[model samples]
Target: MRTLIFATAIRILTPLFLVFSLYILLRGHNHPGGGFIGGLMGSIAFVFHTLAHGTKQTAKSYFSLTFYKYDRKPHHNNLSHALRLLRKNIVRNKKEKPIFIWNYYLLRLRPTYLMAIGLAVAVGSGLVGLVMGKPFMAAYWLKVKIPLVGSVGTPLLFDTGVYLLVLGMVLKMVFTMSKD
Candidate 1:
């Protein structure tokens, strides 16, 4: 059911959707559209790509575009390589025992770890505020100037945690559904 025109249009539009999603994510703290909306927006681009290119192609493209360098080399005995192989198995479903084990690890364990990290980050941000003798989830800001991006805050970190959690959940769903 793939259309050339649809595929081409998706290829062109995906980056724009991703960029716009990031914009929404960053601006969410000060305005509307926080991590939840931004994550949905980002997932929309991948969903569109899946519709246009099929799940396997969409998953491959999404991983390659989003992650760096690991997909290029398959033989590297590293954690990233292992993760890449796991992702590959999600689409391809390799029949070998070792590969199946890896696939199980990736599908079952990795998402949990990601969710845990997201929770830790989100809670840690609030804990920082609590440690500072403020109410939980209180806003904290540092006026130090970093090049390109000036002035950072704890809200951004919390938003980032939300972003990661949403992203992991969305991707886990996508991968699981796509496997069928």
Candidate 2:
């Protein structure tokens, strides 16, 4: 049962949750919060969205591609036709819906891919220490300091890997449950 207020609140809160999750993820290495918490926070956004809308609508809106076909005129040289076509396609796609290229590629990924990539990243971070003549899973850091984030290190990469892994895991669960 979808309610107007709930859907509106979800639309407002989803982006905020995602942004806060990133903040948590970024600050995790130096502070209390880390990848696991941040990933949970990030996953909450989609979960809420799924609750507000159905899983199918949420997936279609965020995890699918919007393709537009444009045909060039043989005689017309001006850009007006192309602009018109673009406008027409945009109108046809959906009213007030924003199409972000980043969302299309990133959110469309299957949970398995996310898990594999996250595992690879986590393992690669550990291997970096071995390559540097240190013990496996040893922490390594760059000399240069980055603003806000401070020193960059292997721990950060490992945290990022954890973040992706957790996000994938939770999303997989959510999608599976939604199917039933």
Candidate 3:
């Protein structure tokens, strides 16, 4: 079902798509493109990969490069381990409670947290203006010189948050629906 030509093309274009996504995200604050558009562009690249390769292969490749490792084999769940440890500790000592470890394996691989974070950031940005006795989402800019990009503003942060939120939501939906 996989096409070699399409896979090769996707491999070549993935980096370009990522870079272009960043460009769109950065330019979005002042121009037409921002986080939502940038996120969609990035997601398209992944979708292209998923189409070229199978979903499992694409996810394995992507996760391997990132923090999470996508393992097909069934294994012990983190919550179960935590619960077992908690029970053991409770029986061993009444004074000390079981401490939940936050290791890499215990790390969240879901987009829900990302969505929450994005919502918080967007809300915080709006709240900043409110705290300053201004209307919500009032544009605030800081004039500064950079090597490539010129001036920046609070709108960029809001845009970035929006981008993350959209990206997470899209990825979550795609992965959830595609799962076997």
TM-score of each: 0.64, 0.74, 0.67
On the 0 to 100 scale, the lDDT of residue 72 in model 3 is 28
Report the C-alpha lDDT of model 1 over 1-180, residue by residue, as the tens digit: 478998899999999999988877787866544777887888788778877877677655555433223233355778987787778777774565544322111222344455677778888988888999999999898888555444568887787778767766876677677763
Cα lDDT tens digits, model 2, 1-180, are 589999999999999999999889889988655888999999999999988998887777766666554333474456885576578676775555542223223336666677788889889999999999999989999999989888989999998898889988888899889973
The best-first sequence of candidates by TM-score reads 2, 3, 1
Candidate 3 or 2, higher TM-score: 2
> What's the true lDDT of residue 62 in model 2?
68
lDDT of 1: 0.72
Per-model lDDT: 0.72, 0.83, 0.75
* Cα lDDT for residue 153, candidate 3: 71
Query: How many backbone clashes can be found in candidate 3?
Result: 1
- Residues 1-180 of candidate 3: C-alpha lDDT, one tens digit per residue: 367888898999988998898889888878765988998988888777777776677667764433445442244467886587677876777676545433334334456766888788878878878888999988787767565556677788788788778877877787777765
Residue 174, candidate 2: Cα error in Å is: 0.4
Candidate 2: minimum summed lDDT over ten consecutive residues — where?
A: 98-107
Spell out the clash pairs found in candidate 3.
Answer: 28-33
- Taking all chains together, the TM-score of candidate 2 against the true structure is 0.74
